[model samples]
Target: MAIIYPLQPRLSSTSTKIVIGLIWALAFSLAFPQCYYSVTQHYPPRTICMVNWPDDYGGKHHLTYQIAMIVLIYLLPLLVMLITYSLIGQTLWGSEIPGEASDHYQNQIQAKRKVVKMMIVVVMTFALCWLPYHIYFILGSFNKEIYMQTYIQQVYLAIFWLAMSSTMYNPIIYCCLNQRFRSGFRHAFSWFPFIKVSEEDKMELQHTQTFRMTRSYRTENTKSTVVRHNSTQHDDHTTVKLMKS
Candidate 1:
């Protein structure tokens, strides 16, 4: 959605939602077999030093499938995210809002830049976390001797956990990088005995709300001014026609 923001859309919201759902469903479906095998068959037995199950799970054909799944799930998404963010960064830096309120325009652009930065961090984190884990599997699948040593097995365990831990880091990143999330976290945890919402945070939240209200008021005022100008023109035209008649 950020990719096409502030522009007229060629597709409806329902179509966009359906397209997103279908893409995610397909990606997950492609990924289900590896998860199913790990859960139902085995959990990285020391014998195989990987998540192979049923004794023939890592057969030549299955290796091919796993390779494809890696491409679809990990690599492809990273590539697309990088491209999308590059475009967004360019657009944010290149475009300017048309108004006399240059300060407000710059503030809006800065806010968007912050959002893009957060998203880039997220995308890079995902790729960094999974790349090593997937490499371990790819090596194990093709070169059976790669997993023989105890040290290598330990390394594999570390990489596997690193990938699993990726899901745990995003909220922390958002909390640290995004003010809205910080304010939200404080509010959500305000009831806790140890958590304190600081005075600065309260002031920041109030300032944000005020800014939004001001923008809304300006928009409404502009619309009303246009309407009044049109009405005045119509009344003048009617008077002129009455005098001529």
Candidate 2:
């Protein structure tokens, strides 16, 4: 949405909180029904409460939940990212920013390209990491015998590792690929003896805050101007009505 309307006023903190709260509530409710559906087994050294299957109808509940979640949580978000990033890529590459100076335009283009590239990498990582995990469960749900195979635990372990790696890579990708994020990261660890934060890093951090403040100021000014214009028109209309009477 920000990419679609960059000039529009951003959501306030209250609005952001409300959105976050609503999403959490909705997600919790969706997963609530199957949360308690599980089976427990006791191994020699450990007790495994095999939730999401074995306790209830695995095909009826677990498989359905798996498919639903795969669509809702994984595929839907991936599709959104792909689409939004594609549009953003087109927007960035399609034309020069109107009225921007040549050098500044090129700089802006380069920065935006880095961001888009980062997003694509992030999306690809997410898909690769989670796709197998989803597929594994779907397959196991359909054929329970697969879970009994000797290599099943190993495959599951590998898939779990890969899926978790997705969560850990985004920061690394941002730090490695983008100068701005790297700069901020360096500044964050500047207190450590081994970490060095340069003047440029400080500027990079400040630049983001400055840009946000400037954008907010412009939005407020625009709103105020509109309000004043409306007030002036109303005053003129009142004056005209009195004169006519």
TM-score of each: 0.65, 0.84
At residue 211, what lDDT does model 1 achieve? 72
Model 2 residue 2 distance off true place after TM-score fit, in angstroms: 3.1
lDDT of 1 by residue, 164-215 (tens): 9987899998998888789878978999999999887897788889978996
Which candidate should be chosen as best, given lDDT against the real structure? 2
Residue range with the least summed lDDT across 10 consecutive positions in model 2:
49-58
Scored by lDDT, model 1 comes in at 0.80
Where is the poorest 10-residue window by lDDT in model 1?
41-50
Error of 1 at 79 (Å): 1.4
- TM-score between candidate 1 and the true structure: 0.65
**Which residue pairs show backbone clashes in model 1?**
none
